[model samples]
Target: MEKQFVLMDVDRNVYEVDRVLNAQTTNIRSFGSEWSIRLQRLHGGLSDGVDVVWVDNGCTRLAILPTRGMGIWKANVAGVPLEWHSPVQRPVHPTFVDQSRRGGIGWLDGFNELICRCGLGWHGAPGTDVTRDADGNVVSEQFLPLHGRIANLPAHSVTVEISDDGAISIVGVVDEAGMFGGHLRLTAQLTTYVGSNTFEIRDTVQNLSAGSAEAEMLYHCNIGRPFVGEGAKLHIAAAEVAPRDSRAAEGISDWPTYTGPVQGYAEQVYFVRPLTADDGRALAVLAAPEGDRAVAVRFDTSTLPWFAQWKNTQAEADGYVTGLEPCSSFPNLRSFERQQNRVVQLDPMGSVTFEFAVTVVSAADDVSRLVQEVADLQQAERMTVHDQPNPEWSP
Candidate 1:
């Protein structure tokens, strides 16, 4: 088989990997395998900066990049913001859904159960919804109401490639029966603008059969290290947070009120706004402890409108972090909703395309200038207030 991605060696660790077209061998004995170090460089070629790198035993994703849920490890983006942790590793051999366990830190506990046993990573949604026993005592806990994940579907793995222009692109595909089946692709291109780093990703669904199929897609990211921490705080441009369980009578209607300086959220996910104030852009911001750098995740509300905010409430034993995810659908919850026509409809032969852009910036990056532009969008004179569609439910 042709090689898909690159393998790296920091000091002296022994590992086997294939870069682009050829298989390569490298040693990293200096940094013991126990370090949990995993990093990728789209360099030693045309670019100077590394694309995405994870350190401390994959406890943290050091750089900026897109992450799909890995079975047994926590993937972090930066130091403080987003973490993707899976304690349960998918079964390696049988390749079928069966109740089993393996001898590793990451092992499959059950169907869709990927727990993070350890690290500074992002904790995922627990599989069982509301587990009630015969006696009606809830045996299991529900993490998020509509969380969804795309794993092992035929070509569902993530792909990163370099263009001849020295620009690198990363794409994640989610399709029917992937690892090969028809899939949905979300692509991102890393480029620079006026001395700053900027990237954009496009979401497209491709049907593989002559007949039609239903498709849903989302871009999941893990941000941690260097950028996230305990003192870190989140600043969002949203006007409100939608109630995930509006069906609950006592559940607050329009449940999440946008209180300025929302704080102390760990392992919490909220459906939020994609509002552009006076100007014409929507922004989500997080301020970390170091340098008080405010990492801003800004996007064009017109393309991808939904955003989600997550924090680490679980103990470190879960190996997760505080995360702010901008997704197209609530994790693992899309399929059921789409079945009820809650998210949207897709004809067998038809497809929908959207885009999301994230810019990691410091608090001094002139956010006030961009915020002014966004504020202008809020005051548009010709628009009706109630006519507004809800800010995307998934960020």
Candidate 2:
């Protein structure tokens, strides 16, 4: 039987304990491995009032934040940390974040999670978003903030599930709606198994409005040392790769490779069309310098057709990290993405789901196996590397 715990239900007016854990009182625990689940709220600084849920499956531990759109704050798989050091040092509360600050790029103030969703309504660079009627008369015009409001919105309801066979799931529901804006609900679930070095995220975004609504999402999966250092590499099967701008074009020849932290290295982003398996599953890996440890993200091209690789190898204090992003559209201005025909339009009460799995391998043998698999997929087709940004894919 699958045991369930209701953490929060707005409609039911239920708000459980401030903290919960698996103990003798509950009489339910995973048998072999040391498994546990805890829910707590932060009390100080920027993290104040943030609701955090922790799940430890013996081999893997995940910290999830329902206050941050059910995003995974961080993860540790088989003793390998899957997170980066961001200048924003805490799990910031949404109240402290002004999405419109700093010229629409203020989303960086709360972007420290290892895996953060970038959309519910729209996820891209901030700009004036205008919608016009069939005859070109403007219907709506407004400035959209950076990355949308999903990342900073709190979940209205959350539930924790434990299966008799030792599977753990944390599900949360967050709605992005307002007066002029339509309603978009995000149902996110994070699942893992006891003693396993893997976890999966399943997110479903639904349009709860009477009229059609625009939708876009990007999974920004970030990592740092020891998975991103000198000699480390990003292993992915890409049929084509292009720089996002001229700055990124400078390093196009060595796009997939990495170097240790530099004092003044600027960030570079590459847009890619990844080669996928027959099943539409695409993979991206960040290997450590020693090649014995690695973290991999498995996604589907059928749901997420675009990929963005962000490399920011600046000094540690400046937030040295890299991002392996999978998205429905490129992270450009919403207007540009719409011009490129990359946004999703959801009908009334319609929904679409996105799913991905993360795995960590510490054994050299296992890492080598994944490396070889990525290489094989890469070689299946001749890759086209654009020296400069592709006008078709970038603004």
Candidate 3:
């Protein structure tokens, strides 16, 4: 027998090699060894029975609570905390109360990372109004809760996805509706990418009813501790800054600076109209005292045309926090806002979208760059006095 020179299958051998090479290349490009998502359920503490999705992308870690209206429970960049936690230690589930018992400072007990999503009919205070019930019977003292119910309501149909490019996204839908009230739905998506120190929030508020609905939205992004104590500074590209009240006006000259916790410092609030860049976006930053660390927010001003700075540097026991809020309108009562023509109205089947991103600046060069940007904005226009004529109230 001739030395069995088995005829070499050239085409078959080439195809096998090509397939293996292609697979290896794809895996190398798509696999993120350091990024992962973990879903966990809490058993004790305020988080008991709460389901959280933790996303870690090597550079940043975020804990998203689906049971808490998809609000972020905690976030950190490179082991540095980025959010403020209230004195109230427990995470209260929305099921604990209905609209009657909810609203007001009572909602602040579990405030962590962020809260105070005001919307629908009312926002700032617990207002009592008379309205017709479904049966056409008049009901008096119908209460509209503080900050609305979106923050406390749980998200339905929550989904988390990880893309081949190592981006993680969490999406959910929250509904705040009643039998004879405005029907509103908030569809939210939170996204971050591997090895990146930034995270983005994209939300769409839709009026699901057949009639026009009044809505307000505010993102109370809070900062505390090392990022908000004495020596820390706030930078905003704002065209105007109006003190919300006489108290805020008292310290209007020092609005950009922060001080150590005062024994009884009344919180100061400033209403800001940010200056839009050529791209129609606005930037704000809160820097550490040393200026080595900073948290910056970039948002589209077309949708969120208003900004509020909340300074609550009272003694620690009383709570020390700073809030950078981007909103559709001032945090006034819905009735008051409507009178000012400041409230946003969504037409039947209409929707509004808001986009914002938060990023940590840790590098010295990046921090310097941010400081320069703030300086440029400060020189462009002096802070505007909050004296816009309003029939509802005067500051």
Model 3: which residue pairs collide?
A: none
The best-first sequence of candidates by TM-score reads 2, 3, 1
Question: If candidate 1 were superposed on the true structure by all CA atoms, what would the RMSD be?
Answer: 11.8
* C-alpha positional error of residue 348 in candidate 1 after TM-score superposition, expressed in Å: 3.6
Q: Over 4 Å off in model 2, which ranges?
A: 135-137
In candidate 3, which residue ranges exceed 4 Å CA deviation? Answer: 1-33, 97-103, 128-142, 377-382, 386-395
Write down the RMSD of all candidates, one decimal each.
11.8, 1.4, 10.8
Worst lDDT window (10 residues) for model 3? 14-23
Q: Model 2, 221: alpha-carbon shift in Å?
A: 0.7
Q: How far in Å is the alpha carbon of 89 misplaced in model 2?
A: 0.7
Q: Mind giving the per-residue lDDT tens digits that candidate 1 earns over 1-395?
A: 11234333223352222232211222222122222223444433222232332323222222322222222223222333333343332222213423222312122332222121110001133233344567978665533222232332222244434333323343434333344233333222222221223445455554444454544443444444444555555556565565333231122332222222223433345556566643344666655554445445665555345666544434433534444555444543432333334343345555656555555554544545444544555454332222222334321
Model 2 TM-score on a 0 to 1 scale: 0.97
- For 1-395, candidate 3 gives per-residue lDDT tens digits of 10111111233341111121111333324344466555566677666767666777778988777677778877888888876757765556666535555445555555665533555445665665444467967654455656777777776556555566666677777787888876899888888887889999988999999999877888888888768878999888777777788788788888888999899899998888887766777889888888888888888988888888899999887778999988888876665665576777889989989888998987668877987886786676765555432334321
Write the residue-wise lDDT of candidate 2 on 265-364 in tens digits: 9999999999998777899988889989989889978889889999999999999999999999999888788878899989999998998899999988
Clashing pairs in 2: none
TM-score to true structure, per model: 0.52, 0.97, 0.84
